[model samples]
Target: MRILVTGGAGFIGSALVRRLIAHTDHEVLVYDKLTYAGVLSSLEPVASSNRYSFVQADVCDAEAVAKALREFKPDVVAHLAAESHVDRSIDGPGEFIQTNMVGTFVMLNQALGYWRGLDEAAKARFRFHHISTDEVFGSLGEEGFFTETTPYDPRSPYSASKAGSDHLVRAWGHTYGLPVLVTNCSNNYGPYHFPEKLIPLIIIRALNGEPLPVYGDGSNVRDWLFVDDHARALQAVFETGTPGETYNVGGNAERKNIEVVTAICSILDRLRPKAEGKYADQITYVTDRPGHDHRYAIDASKIRADLGWTPSVTFEEGIERTVVWYLENQAWWQAILDARYATQRLGVA
Candidate 1:
C-alpha cells in the first residue's frame, strides 16, 4: 500500500514512517510542515529508500494537502501532525487550536473530496487514521483506566484541541461515510523524541549537570508507550481496524513523574555515570503547569483483543534503550538543541 503520513518528520510519525519503509513493501510519502518539533533527522534512517518520499507542507493548507492527496493517491492517510507539547500549549494556545482543530477540519474535508473521486474499490480500501493522546480523557482518579467509551474531559489547551480534532474525524466518518479510524494513545517516549518532553529533558539536563525540573512534587502519573511500539500499533489499526471505531493503545506501564525522572537517572548512572554523585541528585521541584492532569492510563484491552496488538517493551526496557539511544546519538539531539530549543523551561504560569 502507498501511505501518506502527515507530520511524518516528527518523533512518532517518523518512527511509523521508518517502520513502514523498512519492514513492508509499502510506498510512503511523508507530508510535514517542518514545525519546530518536526525534525528531519528523525527520518534519516529511511530517507534514502526509493519507497520513501517527503513533501514539505502544512496539514492546515487545504490546497497543498489536496494536491498531495491527489498526486500520492495514498491507500491510507495517517494524520499525526499537531502542536503536541502540553507545556507549549499552556504557554501559547492559538497555534494548538489552529493546527489541531482547524487543521484537522481541513484534512478531513480534503480527504473526503479525494476519497469521493476514487473508484469504488479505492474508496472501500482507503482509510484515514487519526492519531491522538489519552489526555483527552482528562485526569483519572486511582483505579479506572480510560477506554474508547470514556468521555472526553480535556483540561489543557493541548488535549482540548486534540479532543476537538478527534470529534471532527468521527463526525466526518459518521456524517460523510468516510472511512476513519481513531486511536487515543498513552504518552510516547523513545528515540528521536524532542528534548522538551519529560524523558528527554531529564536525560539532556542530567547529562549537562543541570537541574532536572519536576513539577508539583512530581507525583503526576502517566502511561508510557514506546514510540516504536506505537508505530506498530498504528500500522495494525490502519491495516485491519474497523472504520468508525476508536482504539486505545498503551504500554501498560504507569510511572509517576518522579519515578520517570529517577528511572532515567538510574539508567544514566549505569550507562554514563558521573564522577561524584548520582543523576537523581539534580532533581529539583518546581511549580506545576496550569490545568495539569493528575493521571492518565489507557485500557488497551480493546486494541489487544480486537487488533491483536500489544506493546513489545516494558517501561524499564524502553527507558534503558532510550537512554542508550540518546547517549550514542548525541549529535542527533545536540543539533536540535543547538538549533531550535536551548533546553530551558517553558509553560510557566
Candidate 2:
C-alpha cells in the first residue's frame, strides 16, 4: 500500500513515517511544509529507503495537494499538518486557523475529488485519516475522561482549529461519502520531539541548567501517550477502521504538571547528574496561558476493546527513553537551538 502523510517531518508524524518505512511493506511519501517544528532531520533515519519519499509542500495549497495526490496515487492519506503549539496559538491564532481549519478544508476537498476519480475498487480501499487532539474536549474536572462522544469545548485557538478540522472530515464523510477516519489522541512524547511542548521543553531546559517553567500552581494534568504507540494505532485505524468513525487513543498514564517535571528531574539526576543540585531545583512558576485546560484524559476503552490496541510502554519507561534520546542526540536538538529557530520560529516568543 502507498500512504501519504502530511506533516510527516514533525514529531509524531515523523515517528509514524519511520514506523511505516521500518516495520511495514507500505510505501510512504511525506508531505510537509517544513515549518519550524517540522525538522527534516527527524526523518533522516528512513529517508534512504526505497519505499520512503518526501515532498515539501503546504497543505493549504490546493494545486500542490492535488498534484501530489495524482502523482502518488496513495491508498491512504494521513493528515497531521497543523500549527500545534498551544502557547504559540495563544500568542498568534491566525496561523492556527489558517493551517488547521483552512488547510484541512483544502485537503478534504482535494481528497474527495481524488477519491471520486478513483476506480471503484480503489475508491473502496482509500482512507483519509485526520489526526486530532484530546484538548478539543476541553478541561476535565476532577472526574471523567474524554470519550469519542464527548462534547467539544475548545478553550484555545489550537484546539478550536483542530475541532473545526475534525468536523470537516466527518462532514465530508457524511455529506460527500468520503471514507474518513478521525482520532483524538492524548499528548505524545518521544524522540525527535521539538522542544516547545511540555516534555521536550522541560528536558531541554533541565539539560541547560535553566529554569523549568511550570504554569500556574503546576497542578494541570495530561494523559501522555508514547508517539510510537500512537503511530501504530494510527496505522490500525486507517487500515481497518469504519468510515466516519472517531477513536480516542491514549496511554492510560496520567500525571500532573509538577509531577512530570519532578519525574524528569529524577531521571536526569541519575543519567546526567549536575554538580550544583537536582534539576527540580530550577522549577519556577509562571503565569498560566489564557484558557489553559486544567486536565485532559482519554477513555481509550473503545479502541482497546474494538481494535485490540494498547500502549506498550509505561510512562516511566517512555520518559526514561525520551531523556536518554535527548541526552545522546544533543547534535539533533542543539542544532535547532543554535539556529535560533527554537526561540524565533513559529512565533514562539
> Model 2: C-alpha RMSD to truth?
1.6
Q: How many residue pairs clash in model 1?
A: 0
Candidate 1: 10-residue stretch with minimal lDDT: 340-349
Candidate 1 local lDDT, 31-110, one digit each (tens): 99998898998988997999999999999999999999999999999999999999999989999999999999999999
Clashes of 2: 0
CA deviation > 4 Å runs, candidate 2: 341-349
Question: Against the hidden reference, what TM-scores do the models get?
Answer: 0.97, 0.98
Instruction: Write down the TM-score for model 1.
Output: 0.97
Candidate 1, residue 179: the lDDT equals 98
